[model samples]
Target: MAITSAGIGSGLDINSLVTQLVAAEAQAPTARLDRRQSDLQLRLSAYGQLKSSLSSLSSSLGNLKNFSTFRSYTATSSDSDVFTASSSGKVSKASYDVNVTALAKNHQLSTDPTLAGAQFTDVTDTLSTGTLTFKFGTTTYDSGTDVYTGFVQNPERAAATVTITDSSLEGVRNAINEADIGVTASLIFDGTNYRLSVSSDDTGADNSLEITVADDDGFTNDGSGLSLLSFNGTDNDLLQNEAGVNAGLTLNGIAITSSSNTVASAIDGVSLNLKTLGSASLNVDTDKTKVKTAITAFVASYNAFIGAVNQLTAYNPDTNTAGELNGDGVTRSITSNIQRLLSNPVGVLGSDFTILAEAGITTNPADGRLVINDTTLDKQLNDNFDKFITLFSAYGETTDIYTNFVSSTDDTTVGNYAVNITTLASRGDLVGSAAANLTITGGSNDVITLDIDGVSASVTLSAGTYTAAELVTELKTKINDNTDFSNAGISVDVTESAGVLSLVSRSYGSSSLVDITGGNGKTDLVGAAATSTAGVDVAGTIGGIAATGKGQLLTGTGVTSGLIVEITGATLGDRGSIDFKRGYAEQLGNYVDSLLASDGFFESSTSSLKGRLEDIADERTALADRLNLIETRLRSQFGALDALIAQLQNTSSFLQQQLSALPQIGGSNSR
Candidate 1:
């Protein structure tokens, strides 16, 4: 008979034996793989914690790495009803007396009351179709004669034109409003007639409106039809409801005028918002609250980072158990570098505060956390606040006031470097060879095309007869108001000397270019023959080594590789030297950046740990395959033993049967 199961024929527990043998074969290797996997997982987790804590610490260094963070100032006004003030950057701590003399107003114009017959009877009344061009200028109106004595165009404001298509009174108003040309129009009904009221959106003396109508009825300015709305800086067709004027004020007994109610140029770092006509006392002071808060936050962040590291690398002597990163070389190196940076002195020039210790910041030896001495910090803030800022931020100073330190790269070396200038920056100019024509006629000599600083634009001058000064103002206004020039921030200044007109670019350096390309009015405005000249960049040397120049920016070479400075003064030759220094916060921030980069220590370490874990999984799979083979072989051997035992029993049973039969026969015969 064939043995169906391992111990069926032999009556032995072969299945249990095979199971125990297979488990014994797999136990030791599987346990080893599991232990290795668990350790690698713990290491990966520890690295994640370290990376997270370092990121937090880097974030805390933002305000401490820049000098501008400590340049905050507070401004206050004694009387809020009159004015309110705010300050920024570095401002002197002082008090000033302010007196408001007059408030600014917007210019408003309406249809003349005397022209009652020209008024619209209803909102839907038909208006003459024509182009209405609005020009911005400063108008000196004489009320007694109802005539404008002088008009000067504002170069900063561009002229806007509105075309009337709907022709209805309401349509005209809507069309003007939709233009969005810094002007608003409204229809007002007063008892008998409806009149259109137009107002300037800005409040300034030079922001006045002079509306000129190109009537389709062949009457340009006859005080009838579309012409009734024409002012032209001299017509009485439009009534002046309000005059545009500047806001006048006295700051510390000195008179000041501003186009808007908010005045910023009167004070160095303070902006005064005028509310009413009154006096108020203005006070400016340094604000130290933010600095103290930043310091406290830095301390807290530093301590938290230290605590995370301690937990990640902890060891229990009694249990004989060590933390995941207990003896990790990378962790040790990171902490050591941080400690070294914190203990090093910042080489700040012209200041006694060269380290964090001078500002009452020190490291705790026991836990490697930062500790602050409040009394010492308070004294530093009171006495040398600026110096304290330089100690913890990237700072630079120049010996000459004209040479200003702009920026530097990480490759730039610290310490002083001498600055020597070979040439000063200048702007491009075009001068006229002969006297210019003062009359500009439409469709003849009114348009001109120019290329200024690589930007091209076409300008159309207004048709009129003007004096030399008026022509200068007109040229400047037309050229500066061109769409391309205004958008690109390119401008030119026009001046007249003995009937000759000259144009100059407002920019500096070799790229500053002003060229008269082509136009109908080019010859008339700039004369028959004109001279064009291009600008030149500023040249210089730093620390006796040749440097590079771009406009007013002078970049150093050699030891000062990436150092950049702006030269504003014209005085060439020995200008002075710039002293550059990096503080603790900046240094630490750079180090952290390197460690957290894409190919940084954190990424590499984590990747290696994951790779090891995968290898452990592969090894466990191989061990399982071996155990399966061992189980298969043990079962086969036990099955053969069972079969052999069964066969032997069968043979013995047969022999006993035969022997019994023979013994019985012999006994019977003897009897």
Candidate 2:
């Protein structure tokens, strides 16, 4: 068929054509390899997507499983009859008569009376006398000798002049308030004149103020206008005269108290309904219905998980193929573990409780779907709720099935991760050493060591090695004997198990170092016999003080002082303490309850879902990067092949031209 190569002018040459075809055939295997790699990558990407989806579904199922139901009630009350209910949703017909009595109030008068129009010329002068005082509810200010300067001045006294020289009037006010006297002082501005007035810091008759004047000529006891008996009740009461005034109330059959006003107070062992009277008949079965709702929710969540797992494994007619997790080991393992966990019975009150077929949930062999028998479940919930709780919840001494389902460590493939954090560097306690030149008096005659910064001093006593308890006892004796050590606020304690000697300062607030070393020439037993060779040679000021005074005690700054640790580094890689500045954990728990009551739990769950979506977005970015790289490689390889094909075509054409131009050997013979 190719014999007409000589007739077709400038046609392709046979040999060049054959060579080009053979080169093209050799590249076919490489193309196949590229396609196979692409397929593998696609499969891996599908697997990743499936895994991510499953994880998200699992998280959602976990939340559904944790869903809970709470009961709330309203109350109604009458003056004669009090009603209480064990449960709400139904009107309690039973009623009882009740009687309430108000509590009595206690009152008292102030002891240190101040006459009206009494003025202070100088608060510091009065304070210097070592007795400037006030009273509260007949209780005299006992700390009169420790009084600082005050700022209160009588406005009624025209000739009385008060001039505060050292501190502001506010400072004086703070001092008086801190003293907790019955009278509160305030500054009054009348145009150009500034006057200070003292008022009773209490309510009712209990917090009346009486002023008496002494030595101050301008002060007067005026009985007529704004008399000395003037007792104005303002601010907090100095005397708490109201005794248990804030009592809870449960009126009629309803709780109408100032506090929780719930049905719990309406009747003994009963909660009351405090609602507007109405003819609508309340259904008592509503409470039972709520229990039914909870059961339904639990079943729904359990079934949903089962359905999801089944979808991930079983084949379907619509999809015409097995699920994403078909034949997957992880999926199978999870299913098997969950099934075993649910089926296993837990010991409780002399009986084994389980949540499998007995809970009205039966597994279908075909699709692994759980079918719920509602009738059976309702009966079980109604008859044996406590037992049901025991089976599901970790109530009493029984282990909970729910907790085990989520947190059990038996399955390692998927478990919650716990992270631990620790502070990097912390210093051990400092110790002191004994030297022959330095007199070591006070405390026991045992070897002691001291640490300054990173340096250590070891002073061995003449006695043999002693236990930590013995060392502590000896150290205490030495401390008691030496007045300087005791007065210097230094304390010594030894830990036997760790063989650690600790030196603590009594003055914890002070930032100073205690000097353990005595003077150079002191001839104590420690000073004469102590040798520096065995202990750390602290030459300069020992414990922040230079060696001074012969036979006198060496005094220095106190020891419990150092540079405060300022945390500065990379973002703290640990969860810090969440200390409530003004509240407690119980308050926080109540806050959480309030949040949950206000639908904040749903918001939090949605936020968590949004976070998961962001993770999916990150995965998509990674997939995009991989896709780009694959495309780049594929383009480069394909382009090189196209260029080779073009070159082959050109070579074939050139060979054809050369053959056409070749001399014809048998043309005449053919003619």
Candidate 3:
């Protein structure tokens, strides 16, 4: 058997040819295996992609399951009962009376007039009697004794606002009022010019205005004869007037006050439908419409779950192709479990209304849509609304079924459904717990009660003097010492003006109460009348001398003029103590603290769930990175196989060419 090369020689060399073909055929199995491996790799790659997507989706849904919104409603007879009681057929409504009360205190203004004795005498002065001069704030004006009959016509004199009556007495009174002087004057009209008298606008000696008369050719001056009137007692202290501010109203036993004139500003329990006379109350109603809405939501959620399941199972009737998850054990398990959840009994209020079917909801297996029997539903709502609510709400014993479904940690439980598309799209997460507390304290002779917006507490002191300064100091100290006080939201401060003392709370949202007791106790030194027996008096005198006064002595004074000493324990009147309003500030403080803790939304649970979602997102990012690495390796392997196939084809072509060129070497070439 001779061998020749011409594409490995094709004709008549039976044994040799059979050997070569047999060898080629033997290599075919390896190539076939490689092809099979490649095909499998492609399928596996697709499967891997689908699985990754599903897993990612499942993780996302898991995060959504933790969402506060999704899990906000828990199955229970309470929610269900209220809903059922208010619902009629498809609609459910309920009405509740709510009342809000204002915790603010009333403020009043008053006047106190008490002064020592002071004397004044009336002096008769006529234009012919004398020339008078008035001085005010570094400005001075002079009036001649010539009876200045036509002075009103003089532009230069007019600049001084001078006025004169026909009689000298009346002229003086007119002059006082017109001169813009800080004094009052009147004339006792006599046959002659008149007797003029003047009074200081202020009550005490410090406020007394002086008048001087100068003798002139046309006037007679009574220098020593002039005297002003006398007064005994202190000036009046003006109290604040809070009247005509606004009237507060009570709604349904709730006290509501508003700066606004409308009734809507008063209550929150009911929405006020404003009318011409008053308002109409609108309450939540449980009617057929509402019931239908709730049912619809449930159905939509269920359908979404079914759709997700179908997608995973690759149930594509259009293409007649099975899905990536076709025949998957996990998919089958999920579908079966979900069906169980829909038909399972929810133990609510010990009623037979355990499943949706019992509540007048029927499921159609053909299309998987839940249909509601309106008449039956209405009967249930009217007769046993509470039972219906319990069935839907109660998870274990009287809670919602949905709650039980998502809350089930047991993977094998009937309600233990897998993470689904809805949960992923909704971004649900679980909530966590965190809280804080606040406290406030008042000072001696001080009564401090804080009502935070609506929350109130009181701090009372025994009878004593609660000076504005001391109260301010104590408030600051307490706020600094207690973190909860700041967290709860009260701010404190002090204010002083003229001779008055005031304790102020910087925040105004909440109210607090402070009371002072035993604040009245005085040590002996100055007369017992001088000092406050209770809280420290910042303005009281010691030993008959001004307590705040220093660095001076009454040398020329009588025996009472020794070095001034503070009456250590002199008692001021019972009313001498200071009182502060603090409750409002405390309330405000607490509110601020709550706001900070609850992320300003007032829902701590929701805030906690959001935090969990953030963590899940981080996990998904890490998984994606790992999947990318796997894909890169698969791409590299496929590239190598393609290059090897190209090389094998080229070698076969070269061998064939060589065989053709070496033709007929062993067979009948001589012809």
Candidate 4:
């Protein structure tokens, strides 16, 4: 920009010359960089398209991998008001005539029917402070001995109880609620006197209340004060409706009884919730619409994926346009692998159905997308859905195995198991002497802690004088009534003849162990034996090799892996060998999942493409920097030329002025 006249002295345009030189230098390199950047951008866009296409394909495969995708059962009830029925695809096409008999109800008892219309003077009044004993069923006690007879008792209920801190009619209800004894206590009144009422939490015949009075004030159902709340079998002081009964229903003329109105076991994979008493015909059939929808969706996804890939890889010479990823190796590999998977049959051996083509799904020869024939698919589902389910889902073959085969979902490996029962599983039990000679000085001093497996619970005995048989009966009730012990499946049994006391586990597995630790007064009843006995584990062999045992399940460990099965019945010899077969859907789903999961083939392909794009960007940046240096050098040379031309022009002017001053007639005049 500074004043310069290089052309004035040299008789040439110096600025124009420099500008032309720089333009020539930039022209080839700039074009090359532009083409390289455009290609890199196109490749990135192509990869993006590929990623989108793969995601769509993967999403479609998800439906195939689902276990319930093959379920085709539809259930309809003739009388929806009585009960609504629903079923899964596992249910066979059948019909059942269901008739509701009687619904389940909870045991409800109230104070004498005559006293229902009475009003209490004070609801918060404390009547007595004693142990509120809730004994259920007819389990007798022999006070002549020191401990319980330990014989068969009724099925244990939530017979747990709490100390009688408050004895008001309302206080009693609150205490019963806090005890959580699977029963509810409330007061119902019609304005005269408040009458106490007790109800069971669940609707079942076994759940009933038997309140016995044993307080500190020597109260033992004397019909005075808090004794009004006590009621035994012989006592008729309290009157109410009959005990609760289980719900009764007839399925296909077969009788069924359930503790709740909602019955699921009556039909496989079907739930029947009964309302009013009525008869209804339940029909179950295939849900063809849902199956068709899933199939169509998968087909669409496959088409979309293939279509996107084609757009990127296709080259059209006539149109004079090329695809973004034309001739790209990574894109070609992705397309080829997917095409190979689609073309090949899945699970080629031991299967009647092996590929999508076998299931009436075929590829279009032109576009390489999937297509389905609805009529053929409908026929297959109508014929036998189970076979269709096996065609796509992974299935296990259990020949003659016992011990209730739960399931094996951890790993997928075709396996075989040779069964062997070294010893039958057993429960842990503790037997004690008869209750004919037991002694109890203080009930509070007899606190015992019982642990089933690892679940521990504590219970304290009543603080009153008790006969030997009574004390033993109370101990049995205490142990059976504890929520933790009962939930852990620990029960009590007595033998009056042998006077044997024993503690046992309900389940026949190692996880069902039992332990009992007693303090002071409690120790004297069980012979001061505070010890633990472990439950037994099933012993078996899998695949002709010793298999590791966990409770009742036997799984392959050393020689083989991923082989698992359950054993219940303890036979001396082999139960049966299990064979697993992978169906078409199972094979395809696994393969597709491999392509979509982290570290899968598609992931590697994408990562490689992304890496290349990064390298291209770096190359572009380096070229730009080199071009910048070239431009700077050209500018510098031009700047020097301009300055030199200005200097020469100034010299020419001074020389001309000096000549004009020395010569007489050499100057020329111009207007």
Candidate 5:
């Protein structure tokens, strides 16, 4: 009988045989595909690590790429008890003798009912309902007489009004405190009755307080009801506790005054904070430690980046093994390009200092790392500090002091660019046709409205102004003090020559404009037939190419594209030339940025590897399908062979049984 199972039919193990044959057919090709996929994956990982190292190096090179990072200064004061100082930007290195004469003080006033003998009993005692208006200005007073003599309203501070919804004393105090209008109000008790004290938030001679009241009792300054709070140049219902005063100081024997204790305008790029009355010597000098530290950081980061490259492309002969990116053409090219760029010299920076090697920064031949010589570097920094900075930072040197190198973009190249100015920039001005009226009467010709730089504001000049200088000063103060003009960063310079007044906008360019719009004082202060003219922009060229001009800045085009320079001189001809140089840090930083970009070296290499890996996976799938077909065919062939053998054995058994039956007769006959 033939067996039902595959191998049992012919006494052969066909299932095991088919399995062994399929494995043999699939082994070589499948292993090959798997090895290819693994190699591609390793290469992709190496590229990622290399990208990370390059990015870290790029970030570290940011500060060193700019010249401003090396222009740091330190201001040291001999005695900090009297004053402390700090400096920034390009400041002159010099010693200054500063003497603090006095500190700034704020104005304080208190309601003294003892003069009138009308003291309240409790905090909730009702005063009167009315509006209290606060104005800021300068005031002159007679100490012996205890009376105010004159007042000049400061245009910088706007008047603030507070309403008394609650007539109680404590209620008025809370309301005044909540106004937040540059003043603080509080209730003070001097071991007796309580008094309300109000003080100015600012400390200056021009920041004195003047309180006026619109009382509900129809008397604004009669020392009755809400009128008791009135204190102005004429009325003194409140007693003055302290007068506002400016800080006084002498810088280098020159007298200086500031509204606050922190003074910033006495010296260029330096700020001084006064503490007490005394003397101190201040010295400003270049900070060298910061420059050295920046250079050291650049070296360390470059070394780390090169170390990653070395490991990624290294071959270990001891184990007969190599790295994933070993022998890669892209990797080799990157290394060679970096080395070439480092060896090249910067020519635009002049001959004395150009290359990193001149500044004691040399590369190691054995390990491909940066090595700094401490002694040599210190000598270079001490001897040629400015040249040392130009070695690793982007620097520009100009021939003319007035024509400054403002800035440049990455697209700007190294070389000299000549500057030429066709027209000088000017500011808008309004000149009066005749002399201004000296006398300014209140409610008749004291108010003036003006339009400056497209902004409009009305300023009320002080009445009773006579001298030409005083009128000019008053006009400038009132016009600059307007909130509308100050908020928009617009101002005007007022000057009077031969009794004629001129108003010029502080800003330059075609957008700068000033005009007398409307007011009763328009015809009196600056005549009705005044001339108004708008400013014109500066016109110039750089590197023989017509540049775009806006105010004082001039930008170049063509080969000198992205280069910018500022023309501060009034000359209308050839100004000078700017010698721009791209240092080592800038060149390397740009190169690294290109290599790590989206369409750059690392991205392209990793993408190709990923594609190859995907192809390997497809090859593995095809191999699996081919192996499955082969196993099916082998099982079918083995089953057929086993059946054929079983059939032959059955036939032999039948024949043997027939012969035995026939052979029994022959054996009996032969016996």
Candidate 6:
């Protein structure tokens, strides 16, 4: 190792001087880089604030984009404990008196105690070897006759059966459980004996069970066998624990019956869950408080966003300190646009209800936070609820071309569509045309089975000779006469025009099919020209892009996205469009989205600032490298000078010693 010292030979601190010189050389450059780095880092932080505030503002605008959000209402019941109700904004504000007469009950039946006593020990023990089938049906009561009708078979679900062997009853129960059928089985003890019981999982009169037990051992359940578990009157062996019954209630003096206590479809958008037999007055109304709360949240989020922006772009006169984005054009533009939007009134809605100010929402002059006038808002909501809803939602004006136009959030641009319909939808029809002189005849034994919708009904004709008009009248009367078809909304229109008779379905979809089957030999009687035509779908294009048409409705996606206009009239070529306009919330949301999206200007600006920061970092690293080189060169020069000075000192010391020795001898003569 080489030794280093200061002022050892030349009486000067050369090492210290070299260090001071190197530091002086590095100071200005390092200071400059540091200042640049600090400025870049501060600007990056400011960009982060911008991103966060914009994101927060964007997130808060989600629910406000829908007008339904403002139209939302809450339902209240006078007896909340007995019944609870909820609304989905579609229901009108009305007071309805509801009487919960009875709740639905499940049907349950248990086997006879005498039969249970015949069972062996252990649940694994089986009593017979056969299969037990279960089916569900309903029973209606004839009040006039005072008799209950036979259980009507409903063939929607096939009967579920459980096969039994000489095995444990527990195994049988497990098998039934694993089947995941509608019914559940278990062993019950009735004080003296344990009986096998089964129950229907669903409640209602239509969910009553019919259990049929069949055994290969010839054990017939003639009122005494163990294979009988049913609610039929003849089954005296089994005991009925409970009878399935429908929930009966009255709404505003109107008799209402439901299969279950949870009745949702009975009302347009309200779910009524009956709890007990009681009366409750349900007052459905517009929940203005909830809408106000949502509006308040939006205002708060927006204020927070603007607050962050102001802080990032503020300038302090005393400290002569300006924020990072104070002079940025984008920041100035963003501020101006938001302020303008917030100040302006929404003019689409009428003059009376245009803008937030008219709706009782006003901005604070100091901070731009929205403040609501509760009383005024309540009055507006009560006076004109629909108009208030239309304020935040785009309502397209119907034109001669299109009738029902629905605008959504994706409907950003306002324009019309030149619709050209190449084909219009046609309903399926059966033409029963015969020879000009043929007369339709019907016998008493002749049965006409008509299949409409997905249900079929048969009617035995009365013996008569009928004309084409009479036959059409009879068919229409019979189809509408059936209760099932009427309840299923099935209608058949039979027309006789120009000596030709035809039957057409009222529905226009592909699922709307009508078949006339089982006429026996009546095919020639009705004159074999009976035929069906396929229903055609409305096909065309909208806004130069191919549109999807189903029946009378035409919808477009992509270029014409959110375009849903129903074609009610037959305009073959160039059907006009409904003009769509954007609402206030939608416009604001779109602007915010543009500012914060992945390819947004905020991201671009942040990237540019970070790039400059990277450049500053590189300059700082280079300054450090130069300082190292300068220190190395200064140490080398000082080291050489120290060596030369040390050599001179040594030479001088030797000469002094020689001179001292010679001076003692030359003191008297010559030195």
Reference-based TM-score, model 3? 0.31
For residue 151, give model 4's deviation from the true position in Å: 17
lDDT of 6 at 405: 65
* Number of backbone collisions per candidate: 0, 42, 130, 30, 0, 7
Better of 4 and 6 by TM-score: 4
Residues 1-671, candidate 3: write the lDDT tens digits. 97533233322334454445445644555455456555444444434444343343333322222211212221112232122111111222444343322222222212111111111122333333333433111111122321111111111110112324322444555665776645566554334323344543322112222233333333222212111111111111111222112234444556555422333333232223221223223354333344445555555555554555566466668878875557767446545744665565554324456567766778778756567787887787667654433344312121222111212111211121111111100111111111100122223223443332223454332222233333334334443334444666644443333313233444321132221112221111011222111121123322232323221111111212222222212233221211111111122223323333436422443344355555545645654565456445544444454455556777899999998888585678745
List candidate 5 segments past 4 Å from native. 1-5, 116-121, 142-145, 348-352, 429-506, 514-532, 652-662, 669-671
The lowest-lDDT stretch of 10 consecutive residues in candidate 1 is 111-120
Error of 3 at 128 (Å): 41
Model 4: worst 10 consecutive residues (lDDT sum): 145-154
TM-score between candidate 2 and the true structure: 0.34
lDDT of 3: 0.34
Models sorted by lDDT, best on top: 1, 5, 6, 4, 2, 3
RMSD of 2: 21.3
Superposed Cα deviation of residue 544, candidate 6 (Å): 12
Clashes of 3: 130
Ranking by TM-score: 1, 5, 4, 6, 2, 3
lDDT of 5 by residue, 1-671 (tens): 94389878688888889999999998889788878878888889988988898898788888888778767877889999999989887677789999999998888888776755337667786768888888777878654577998877665555668988887779888888899888888888766667778889999878888887888778877766677677887678777888888999998999999878889888888899899999989988776777888888888988998899899989999998888779989888887888787889977435758888888999999989999998988888877887865577677778888898778788787888888899888899999988999999989999988999889889998666556866887788789978999999999998888889999999988888889989989999888799999988888888888998887788888877888887887688889898888888888888999999999988888789888888888888888899889988998899899989999989999999888777465565776
Tens digits of per-residue lDDT, candidate 2, 78-100, equal 43133233454323334444323
Consecutive 10-residue window with the lowest summed lDDT within model 6: 435-444
lDDT of 6 by residue, 288-329 (tens): 776666666777888898888778788999999888888878
Steric clash pairs (candidate 6): 123-169, 123-170, 124-167, 124-168, 124-169, 125-168, 401-576
Residue-by-residue lDDT tens digits, candidate 4, 532-595: 5677877777667787777777776654455566777647576776655555445555666677
Q: Give per-residue lDDT, candidate 2, residue 608.
A: 54
What residue pairs clash in candidate 5, if any at all? none
C-alpha TM-score for every candidate: 0.90, 0.34, 0.31, 0.77, 0.86, 0.75
